[model samples]
Each structure stands twice: as structure tokens, then as C-alpha cells.
Target: MTQQNPLPQEDQQVTLISVRDGNISVTSARALVVKAHKIALKIDTALSEPPAWTDEQSLTMIYTHGERVMRLRGVLREQVDTDRITVEPVGEVKEGDRRDYRRADVDARVYARSAGTQSPTEARAAQVALQLAPTSNAFIPQVVNISGSGLGFTAHEVFSAGELIDLRLVLDQPAAALVNVIGQVVRAVRGEGDALNSYAVRFAELSEADQDIIVYTVFSNHFAAEGLSDALDDFDE
Candidate 1:
């Protein structure tokens, strides 16, 4: 039987209204800090082949630090409507799986709430690390995959969706300045036996200089490396 991909009917907008320590509430638009240690969010395209649509549900999320499981909750609010989505005790928060679901391409327009707006032209690929100002939890992630506007990485700490956060990124090497940024934990995923947790993050705001640096350092290098690697592979063949 063919598996069905999970898709949202409309654009979802989540808000972190409050937080007591590590836990948070979605009452206003704010930056989100990632806390999940093992994330495995995948885009299931059961709604459309090659999925012409963009919205996705972080259908699965698991939070584990070392061997212990952490239960969590989140809210998904629609941008086009007043409907709100809440996921509680989010199923089973566990490891990732290789064949549990199809990895559909996600090209959604995810935005983070901030006092200011940063253009998508400022979007770039960079190794970002985050933590809540009040807490000492650090969200160190491994960027397993990325796109022009989105990023996929892994972490194991449990963070409520829509939580606010301060981000520091390791910009492209050589001049790898630790640039500050504000973003949200748009989506998260985890499975029964998967190795690493996966997350999809969207940037909310950044400085112009930092944005240029990111574009040149992160986005340019990624593609340039891919092109070079492909050429070398072709040469080898």
C-alpha cells in the first residue's frame, strides 16, 4: 500500500504566548529556540505528487536527551484563517527511521515573527546555534539538508513550537563571524528508531551586513561546492 503524506489544508501560523522556564506559550509572534535532541521531520507528499503545494504538518516530533524521552506540545495557527492546531503529548518521541516515511521535498514559505522584517533575499545557509536567554540550553544542530529558503538539521532537546530564541551562526569560513539572528522553529520531526532528530527552521530577522555575509558565505559556498563536486564526479566517471 502506498503511504499518504500529511499536508495542512492552509498556511499555519503558530504563536508562543507564554513560557515558564523552558516551556512556552504562543500569544505573540516571536523567535523560536530549538530544544529537540532528535528531530526527523519529513514532507509527506500524499496530498500531491511531487507536491505542488507548500504547507506541511510537522506530523511527528520526538524529544530525547541521551536515552530518556521528553514529552512536549505545540500550536499551529493558520495565517489565512483563525483556526488553531494543537498537538499534545505528540505521539511517541523517539529515534529516526530510514523507511518509516517518504522524504518529500518541502518548499514552504515559513516566516518568523520579529519586531522587524528581513527580506528573503537575505536568506542564506549557515550553521546556526541557539539557546533561550533565560535558560542555559543550547541547540547545536547538524544541518543534514538545506534549500534556498529553508534548512533541515538535527537536535535532541524538547522545545515548544513558536518559542522565541536568540540565534548565533557560524558564518562561512575564513571570516566566520558569529552573526546574531532571530528565527523560529517552524517544524520538527522524530520517529520510533531513527538516529537523529530533524528540524525545519525559518529566519525572521537579521542585519543587512550579516545577510550579505550569509548569502556569500553560506548560500554561495553550498551551491559552488555542489557544482564542483558534480563536475569532479563526472570527470571521474
Candidate 2:
């Protein structure tokens, strides 16, 4: 998020959600934060793909910090090349309690496979996927953010919406915790390139135990980030 008076801080990430004619699209091929005030949000298309978003497109920018989620409306101000976008906050920022399914931005890589949709997320399935991750059959993608119900990642492969996927996520926030689950692609977005780097998967038949594991990891990562920011402030002081 741009370090404007109300915006979060420099280098923070924000999700830009756009809806047009009854279709809701999570424009993730390219979109991130830099800084500013009164700036209309300029969401970018995938750097590899030619720009597709039009100027003056309205959007909702979502920024989550700790237990709070800040939502601000904005419009396309200016496209900063193909890799960056700037949004001018439109109205009063609405702050709300983060839902129980709060998400945390993360960086991790896990094993992925798409045969069809919807399968049981059992312990056995997770174990098999973990073993396969080091092998060639698995398409390893970089996991970006995660919540109890789903996760977001970017990869070279394309998985269409409603497609069921089997995932083997090994998270380090809980020290090499393994999450084996079947999820349906809620959103699959491509960058300018051939890669489908922006994908959101919603868990199907995720066990309560598995869900707890994700929630634990989410909180672990969230607090760790906050702790680091606090340390930085103290050092500066």
C-alpha cells in the first residue's frame, strides 16, 4: 500500500477487485502498491500480456493488517507501465473486523495437480502429494497468500475456475506443516505472459484438523510480520 496518510504503508500489498456487468473479477495478473493520496487506483494487466484494463475503471482496493481489513474504493488513475498501478482513494476508508476466515499474504511453494474437480482432502492424500513434490509430475507453484478456506498462488500452468485441484502445501510458519487438500479454482487469472500466476483455490471437503493447521499458520505469519514492523519502528526510534 502506498504510504499515504490513510493507506497502510510503503510496500504493502493490496488486492484490487473489479466487477463489471455482473461478473466479478479479481484482477491479479498484475496489481500492487507504491504510494500516494487522492490517487485513483491504476490496476495493471499482466506484464507479459498486453494491457487489457481500460482507463478510469472503478475498483475496490482491499488491504488487510492484523485483525482489520480496510476497504477503499478507487478508479483507474494512471497505468505506471505494465507492472505497476496507482489508485486514488475515492471515499472514506471502511474498516471492518477481519472475518474468521482471515487471510494472510504469504510466500511458499507447494505441489499441485489437476485431474478433475472435488476429492476428499484426507491425510493419506496429503502424504502422497508431499512425496511427489520432489518428483517431476507435480507442477510446483509459488503460494502467495492463504486462509482457512483457500489459498492464492501464481504458476505457469492454467487451472480454470470450478476445476478441482489437489494441493500439497508445506508451510514453515508452523515449521514444515503439511496441508493436503482438494480445492476448486474460485479464480484463475493470467498475466501478460503464458503463465496463470494469479489463481485462487477454495478448499472442498477440508477437514477441521486441516483447517486449524491453516489458521494457525496464518496467525503465525501475520504476527511475525507485525513483530518485524514493530522492531523496525523501535530501531528507527
Best by TM-score: 2
Error of 2 at 196 (Å): 4.5
| Model 1 worst lDDT run, 10 consecutive residues | 45-54
Point out where model 2 deviates above 4 Å: 1-98, 117-143, 194-196, 227-237
Candidate 1 lDDT, 90-177, residue by residue in tens: 3333332321111223222212222222333333223232223312234342333432233555555443455433445543232334
Per-candidate Cα RMSD to the true structure, in Å, reads: 20.3, 16.6
List lDDT for all candidates, in order.
0.32, 0.57
lDDT of 2 by residue, 1-237 (tens): 755325644444345555454333344222244444544233323212223456677766555544345666777677776655666767667663344355787656577667453445443365454455433445353546898668888766677898877766766543455577777889987788564657888777555445545664565465456443332221111
TM-score of each: 0.34, 0.47
Q: Candidate 2, after superposition: displacement of residue 94 in Å?
A: 25
- Candidate 1: what lDDT? 0.32
- For candidate 2, the C-alpha RMSD (Å) to the true structure equals 16.6
Q: Each candidate: how many clashes?
A: 31, 15
Assess the local accuracy of residue 141 in candidate 2 as a C-alpha lDDT between 0 and 100.
38
